[model samples]
Target: MKNTSSDIEEYLVNVPEERKEAFKKLIETISENLPSGFEQGKSSGMIAWQVPLETYPDGYHCTPGSPLPFLNLASQKNFIALYHMGIYADPELLDWFVSEFPKHSSRKLDMGKSCIRFKKVDDIPYELIGELVQKVSPQQWISLYEKLYKK
Candidate 1:
């Protein structure tokens, strides 16, 4: 189910009680370490950090006028999921994250093309996620996105 909150803070307030603290901490970690040029907003009901439309006038091709999405965090029914567009677009980054997962946590990585799922709130590797959040700048993400989009 999608988060229906129009505002980021409201979305936070609505997170299920069991996942509240970890979800908030993960959000805080991303906010603290996210590279410059990204703006925080709500996208498709999830909390998103994106390259602003003003910065990248083309916006998201999938949703005209929307910013170019970088990362999104959602509290799903069973897990907290972080969707990172860069990891989907960049193979090196995906490989790096896969290789690094074991060093950060013992729990097996639960992931999809772009979604990294943390089933146990306490199992989330906040430090590793913080580092992952820093690996891509808005400009870099835009360039990577364009290269893939143009293909």
Candidate 2:
């Protein structure tokens, strides 16, 4: 069954107390590392941090006046996934990810026009991930996005 926002929240709430704490820590780390102005919201059952409307008036759909997400985090039945939006738009970044984190197979990347799916918290390189987040300030990311995804 496709999970919804409520479902995901409920799942997180019911996790073993220990795991729940770990999840919270992970969430906190992500929030702390992300650039300012990235708002968090529930979208399609996942916790997402996205570009503000002013930055991408059209949203993730690349449509005007739509609410879109650039990144998402979710706890699934078996693992957690962190979705990164730049994987598809920034070839250099993607290449860097592959070269720097060679242990992860290409299959781990669920490439969309701008999404990188990472299963399991351990599957990610937290330091590098933080660097990725820091590399493009929120404003810069939005501006680059506008240029790359002009519609």
Candidate 3:
């Protein structure tokens, strides 16, 4: 499930033609709204934003050598998948997103525990994602991560 490729450009080059622009826009929305201290790179075969090892030396408990993933944006076989760790771990955040989704997009949400799937692709809610990106900062994620997963 993890592509060893470190190059994000190569990852984008392979996204289905129809999904490319929207995918890129989501990336832009996240990058623009992301707070200080999280780094963007390729992780788990997707374009990801994470708290770097420098900021959180413990890394991911599931994969200690890797950065602690906050969000991962991936082009999947069936849909665009956005995996956001905060919303999965934080009840208030999850509720906020579930409530706000309808205000931003008419399509009913297709979501997993932490993964938001945009099967229609064209209807992906970029604004809501931008707001979600701003919801958790690096320190907040690290503190939450330690409490929820590092044990």
Best by TM-score: 1
Q: Give me the runs in candidate 3 sitting further than 4 Å from their true place.
A: 1-5
Ranking by lDDT: 1, 3, 2
Candidate 2 lDDT tens digits, 1-151: 2345365467567654544655666567778888888887767677777777876566765455656566777666655566677666678877876676545443455444544445444455566566666655667667777778766
Which one is best on lDDT? 1
Backbone clashes in model 1, listed as residue pairs: none
Off by over 4 Å in 2: 6-11, 14-19, 62-64, 102-124
The global Cα lDDT (0 to 1) of model 2 is: 0.64
| Candidate 3 colliding pairs, count | 0
Q: What is the C-alpha local distance difference test score of each model?
A: 0.93, 0.64, 0.91
Per-residue lDDT tens digits for candidate 3, residues 1-151, read: 3434668998888888998999899999999999999999988788999999998888998997889999999988888999999999999999999999999999999999999999987799899999999999999999998888888
Name model 1 segments beyond 4 Å from true: none
Q: What ranking of all candidate models by TM-score puts the best one first?
A: 1, 3, 2
Model 1 agreement with the true structure over 37-64: per-residue lDDT tens digits: 9999988889999999899999999888
How far is each candidate from the true structure, as Cα RMSD in Å?
A: 0.9, 4.0, 1.4
